[model samples]
Target: MSDDQAPSTENGGGGDVETVEKSEDHKKLVDFGLDTTVADELEKLFQAKLVTYDDLDPRALEAIRDFPIECAIAVLKQLLADSNLQHVNNKSAYICGVMKTYRQKQSLGEDKPAVTNGPDEKKLKEILDRTGYALEITTGQRKYGGPPPSWDGGPPGNGHECFVGRIPKTVYEDDLIPVFEKFGTIWDLRLMMNPMQGCNRGYAFVTFTTAEAAREAAKQLNNYEIKPNKKLQVNVSIANVRLFVGNIPKNKSREDILEEFKKLTEGLREVIVYAFPDDPKKKNRGFAFLEYDTHKSASGAKRKLASGRIRVWGSEIIVDWADPQDEPDEETMAKVKVLYVRNLRSNVTEEELKKIFEPFGEIERVKKVKDYGFVHYKERDSTLSALEAMNGYKLHEVEINVTLAKPANENKARERRMRRERDNNMNMGYDDYYSSYPPASFGPPPPMMRGRIARGGMRGRGGMMRPPAPMDYYDDYSGYGQGYGYDDYSSYGGCYEDFSAEYSPHPVTPQPPHRGRGRGGHHAPAPVAWTSNAAAAWPPWYAQRSGGYGTAWRGQSWHQ
Candidate 1:
């Protein structure tokens, strides 16, 4: 045959003259035996524009830790299976941590058990009578001696925690805690660690019992020298307890949606889905909200989801903070006497909680449920007094969260929306971020109707497909949270052609009767005329003005 059909045999005597060239990736794919080629794909995605390590770093880890090469390869394979470079910001560094954890556990012979931090852990714990922190080597996030067993008041409120940056990698809590405790009870101190280097990632968060303490820390600690020349940068952090989730399946039900999220991560306290109003089948508008019990839990879940370690329906979903609702009106919070307190030390008694707050206000009663409890004050002033004094108050060494108690469905999002509308401030959309369902008074879904509109026929910017209320009373409503007026923007056929996830609902103009129809003398209102000034009245947060359907704002389709 011609040389074109030549066989490879560089090592042989004239049997074949050519040999297959094996690249590093080629050797890895054979040795790791993973089902995915994500690393290879990432290499291609970045290409010559950026350099990335697509090959395994297990050898370096094995070389340093004396861990078996086989185990290191095994860990590398698992990490690579779901490894999208977009998710793992630093693949090589992340692998280093995994190998370290595996080595520690394998040596202890506890294939899987609680974190035994070994030598470093032992030394940290030895410094105190009782070690309060736990360790997880796999993530390279370990806690040294933990928070004290208990504090005197409730957990801190928003802004009770502050960020500390520009840290030296070698610093630990032992060298930092004593200096900071002068401001208030230290609720939590977290130093981000890099397991590969056995050092910190150079930042930490210090949470105290009160916002005052946190602000004080930020004020006094800013640019304060922690080491010889390493000054710290501190800023009080706002607590974020909710996360925005996008690109979910439009066909999911409330129960179905919750189940999907519950399977992927924890601290999924609530899920909110926007449903298509006009569709009798009640499919969602394809986005939802997830609320967590604690900022820590929310942050953890965000990392897992954002890291691309989790997927919905076999597809990646979007994760970010929902538009922030302003802090609940101080006036509204000031009007209540009942206090909702959470994050109490698990075993603390109700009597103890009541007693802690009693000094600030006369207690009406105390209701305890698991780690959260409620304190009722005899008067509004007492309630306000207790909220200010006890919020972020530490009790039994556990920092508690104390705030005005709210009934189910009355979340901060709705409150802010209402306040914003009352001030005639700007165009406002209903942000039911805190509730999966609307207020109790929102009632049930109204009956569906064609040809007839409800007494409250509301019209909006052209082309928004709203759930149609009955033409008097023709079709019964079929879903929870679907009965509210003008909640979300879900376009249907013949409606807006340029809808986007970034789109928000606009103001509604009541439909006026233009012609007398059958029964009740109700008249069909004329279609609303879109105006240029309508967008000017939009809430300040909306970066783009509405120009009706087919209109482009900031390079995005408005209603479509």
Candidate 2:
């Protein structure tokens, strides 16, 4: 056939494109000489709609595709440079391990940056120097800073650091250093970066050689515009040297993490990984705090890892300066001025609790529950002062312990108690029976049930509550005690406020009488028997001792 008459390769766009891609994929699969079972299974899964897929996404279709050999070699060398690969024996094992890690990352639906297609180290450095961004993007963050060529070796003096905020994430050190240096020589200028997005976190810390320079920078650069319609917030700030390392493999132990990081970076002093108290395997929370010997070392490591050039444990790791969380955050402290005061003398009173904490701040409210109580302050600063002073202050011959009332626990507990209280109130049939009785005089409750009458919202022993099942919600603090009256509070002594307290402390609210109590009021005279359908003028002795609900026991008719 004439060339013009021949079927065009592009005659069917999708068919031709798919055929070419399949051919290329086949070639790639054949060249790698690796198993295609993973790819095949995924394809089958997609066909059956058992798993999600993006047909247009290359990773979805080529999940098991081979990488460029050159890129693979470069990565292997980098890994070897950072770690001892003795765990891996031969080329086959290495390749399998690498592919397995890659597959696992892909399975997590991570969008892999084109490490091979991106600029090389030199080109990347040039680009970072020019545009302040890296071509190879991944999750986590980075930091970049260096000390000025000054003489003093001591740390930045008090008030020598200023926080620069509201910065455009697009602007980096290349643009910021020159502008800030105009004030004075910078001791250290660290810009926080979000590597996943290849941008700043809109804040940085600029430390000057002298406190005067720091003040000058804050005065001049405060509200200075770095980008159109954006002003920087420059104010004195405290400096930190710890880093937050995220995206760590959950299986890695503290020892594994510390050892790996020590080799990759200098001056790594400690690795802090927190495990859930309830975790059986004690896996890390997929992140850790790394304390470096010096801020310089921490900054250097951040810069290196931020370059998108290295991976830890064959996985992308994120790094950023750690935010201090040993205490309540400012926002939380602002809202909750309540202090958790414990370790009090048994003789301590509500007045004593108030008197003790009132010296630090204006007292808002105070409630003494046995050996411990909570004092609410009108201001956070006052709460802080009280917290610091009274944490171990001696009161009544006992070292009083105090801390910020963690509203999270208190709030959660209050909610549960309120719910449990509602349930208990809803289940009390005898209270309804007593509250809805008529004006006709009823002799006191049956003689045998007299002293056994459950007090504090309990009428006929039905209000007897139980502690939360240990297997369900484990807690380290006392439970929220329910009753509010001083008499009840004193007797209960914050029992419900503490989980370990022996008494069940559900405070009952006066709910509308149950519908079964067809006629009811809040304060009605007690009657011996229900006018509508009394179970018995007097129940047998055994019936009063072991009563049951739903049959004249829980505000229901015995006949029904």
Best by TM-score: 1
RMSD (Cα, Å) for all candidates, in order, is 20.1, 22.2
Query: Compared with the true structure, what per-residue lDDT tens digits does model 2 show for residues 1-560?
Result: 54322322222225643111122333344444523333333333333433333321444223234654433433333333332222222334333444445445456775342122111345436534653422222222223334443345655633567778787766765567668778876766666554333356677777777767877788798889887898887866534446766668778888998999888888777776544323426456566767675557777988887667889988777565542211223454456567766555567788878876778879977766434577868888898788778777877555555666544334435544444445446655535544543333212222233332222132221222322212122232233221111111111111123343333444333433321111111211111110111011111122221111111221111110
For candidate 2, give the lDDT: 0.47
- On a 0 to 100 scale, what is the lDDT of residue 481 in model 1? 14
Candidate 2 stretches greater than 4 Å from native: 1-170, 178-187, 192-223, 230-342, 345-347, 354-393, 401-560
Stretches of model 1 off by over 4 angstroms after superposition: 1-127, 130-142, 145-160, 194-199, 209-212, 227-230, 239-241, 247-260, 273-285, 294-560
Per-residue error for 215 in candidate 1, Å, reads 3.8
Q: How far does residue 542 in candidate 1 sit from its true spot (Å)?
A: 21
